[model samples]
Target: MKSWPRPEVPTITTADFQLRLFDTADQVIKPVHMPATGPVGMYVCGITPYDATHLGHGATYLAFDLIHRLLLATGRDVTFVQNITDVDDPLFERAERDNVDWRHLGTSQIDLFRSDMENLRVIPPQHYIGVQESIDDVIDVVQQLLDNGAAYIVDDPAHPDIYARRDATPQFGYESNYDEQTMAEFFAERGGDPTRPGKHDPLDALIWKARREGEPWWDSPFGQGRPGWHIECAAIARRFLGSTFAIQGGGSDLIFPHHEYSAAHIEAACNEPRMAGHYVHTGMISLDGVKMSKSLGNLVFVSKLTEQGARPSAIRLAVYASHYRQNRDFSTAVLAQAESRLDTWMQAVRRADDDSAARTLIDTVIKHLAEDLDTPGAIAAVDSWAAGIVGAKDASNASTELTGPGALVAQALDALMGITL
Candidate 1:
């Protein structure tokens, strides 16, 4: 007998890869390849610890958690890290408004974030790094940029700022896809206050910022201060995952100044071409046909959603029922639909006891999922399979299908949607 050859492992490719709006239209993320090899190094831009985690945050993180699980299931040893922006400007404002110590507020909100994650069944990151714990890393990156002439310190007594040297890198707007010339023209055309502290160029962003009275701080190379909003993520991501990682995911709002500035800082500090191989951003969650945002006063607190009798599974299903990149309108009706769909799958699984029908449904759904994590397509596939089983001509085959792959289909669908049996 001839010796058998070894089976080649399947390689993940960017073709038909499911990606969302990062910073630009053309910026896309592919699977980890040679230079960027890893157990799928991933960094999700985490919450600012000021308020309770909301439905939007739930949608975003659950999406990431699904991707993380899928990557793991695909045989990648994943190291997922998420940073808590525990000491940003908003924390101070909220602290002052609430008349609580900044440290206390940070601790409280971090607790809340953790609690919310547990409630939603979103897995915690392998590393839950917070801005306060990683100040030294933040300072080190800032110092690197300064040494490399990609950063400069401003001395305004009121609110000093460490600005990235936008002129040093021609690729400042590379991630954002904003034309530098156009940006300059736009800024020049609309001049604001000329003497505002640390407002040198409209495009320049802070790497380090002086602490305000009653704000958090640490002794840094720059001064007694805190890291800028963007720098915190860069430092934390670099410290946890190497300079180059598989993917960076966050809300679509972070695309511009936040993720863009982080990219510049990483390039300056690490002297690397890419901070992350691909940047994945999720769309906003809306309420009642409008965007659910705190500014809009239409935000649905995760706590409140639970109070209103929304199961975490149902919420997850509703948001993910549509593509992650598509704007998801959050309403009770949508949740009802998700609940209904989940019930159908559960019932089908309960009835399924054989392999053939169940296997057919599972195979079809898996194929659709492989197509760029096309979950909507996959869900439709499940619906079709269930419908077929219900309409099967042979009663014996239908029963067999239910016993076999039909049950497996429910497990698979639940695995994808974080829905429980």
Candidate 2:
């Protein structure tokens, strides 16, 4: 019998519509279609840049990086934009806690994050707009929201933050599937004090907040203060990715207030359908079955992982070993397994002599990747081909076909999983 043909490229299949794991149950992500010959646009919510980049951060960025790479491999043009939230409430608190200037802290941590991205071989996005640099744009967004009556500045004696009142916008809780009544009840149960001086509603978060003691300051129509944590992304995404883009992705923790608020901000600002076509959120990385936390003393730094002799490629492989949407456990053992698998795939790639068969195998993988990024399934296909060759009852056919499929597998795996040997 003739030997089975290897895949044409490294990708997932479009025919496969596997359930995309999403934290937002009612959230529906529509595929982006571009007039030109490529993907429409992609925007990912970025970090606040305080602590050293950790395993959880790596998982989130790498998952999207892989998605970007796979989209390009499938012959789609992609404009990937990830923002840098350099000014916000969190940055203020962190800077105060450490007795550092807010700008200095933001700059320091942003650089560290860039280094982490470089170390992990995560592709640099075309746009990395920082909140401080984009203050004018954020101000513009705030002004628009105010004009639309979607935002109102009120004084709070207790909290004193300039709030975007929930009562102002009918679409306030639309993204999170919470009606007005539900939102009021939700925040009330959680100790929301709407009557505390200036707040119109208990659920209102800050759009542009007044400068607090020991925090950052930027001049705006509202006051001499900085943008709020959630407003930065909302404004930055509008400036770079426009009202609606291809996909918006980040950690699942951002789903509620961060992402949900961004959705409202965009709608109130632009009167658009949705901020992004699809919403993709990755699950957190856990250490010892607990979510990664510096407070819990279980945070694992990606840089530290390398210092302890973990290979960069292996670290990436360990990250992608499971579905991008699944919660991944960080362990040295799993990383070792990743390294071992790479070695096997590379060995097979090196043995192949036929370029035609290699190309065919690569194309097969590409098809696999396009199917909602079915990486695990794609890896399974490669492994099955390798296993067939090794366990084949026939010798001559095995020897001929094995080399090509094996070589192609390594190349394609690198394209999708960043596994290079």
Model 1 score (lDDT) = 0.70
Clashes of each: 11, 28
Give the per-residue lDDT digits (tens) of candidate 2, residues 1-421. 1111221334532222222324253455334444354455778888777875888988898888777776655456677777877766567778889988877887777777777777677766777777767889888988898888888777554334566655554545555676667655655443244455666666776787677775667787666777776778888888877888767789877766677777778877888756665677887898867788867979888888888887777787788778777887877678888787665555555455556655665666655555555667766666655554444433443343334445456656666656654
lDDT of 1 by residue, 201-279 (tens): 6667677877777666789766788887778888988888878877788887777667777777888788877677677
- Over 4 Å off in model 2, which ranges? 1-30, 35-39, 156-161, 167-174, 178-196, 353-364, 387-407
Query: Once superposed on the true structure, which residue ranges of model 1 sit more than 4 Å away at CA?
Result: 1-37, 157-159, 180-200, 390-403
Lowest lDDT 10-residue stretch of candidate 1: 1-10
Error of 1 at 201 (Å): 2.7
lDDT top scorer:
1
- For TM-score, the strongest prediction is 1
For model 2, state the Cα shift of residue 120 in Å.
1.8
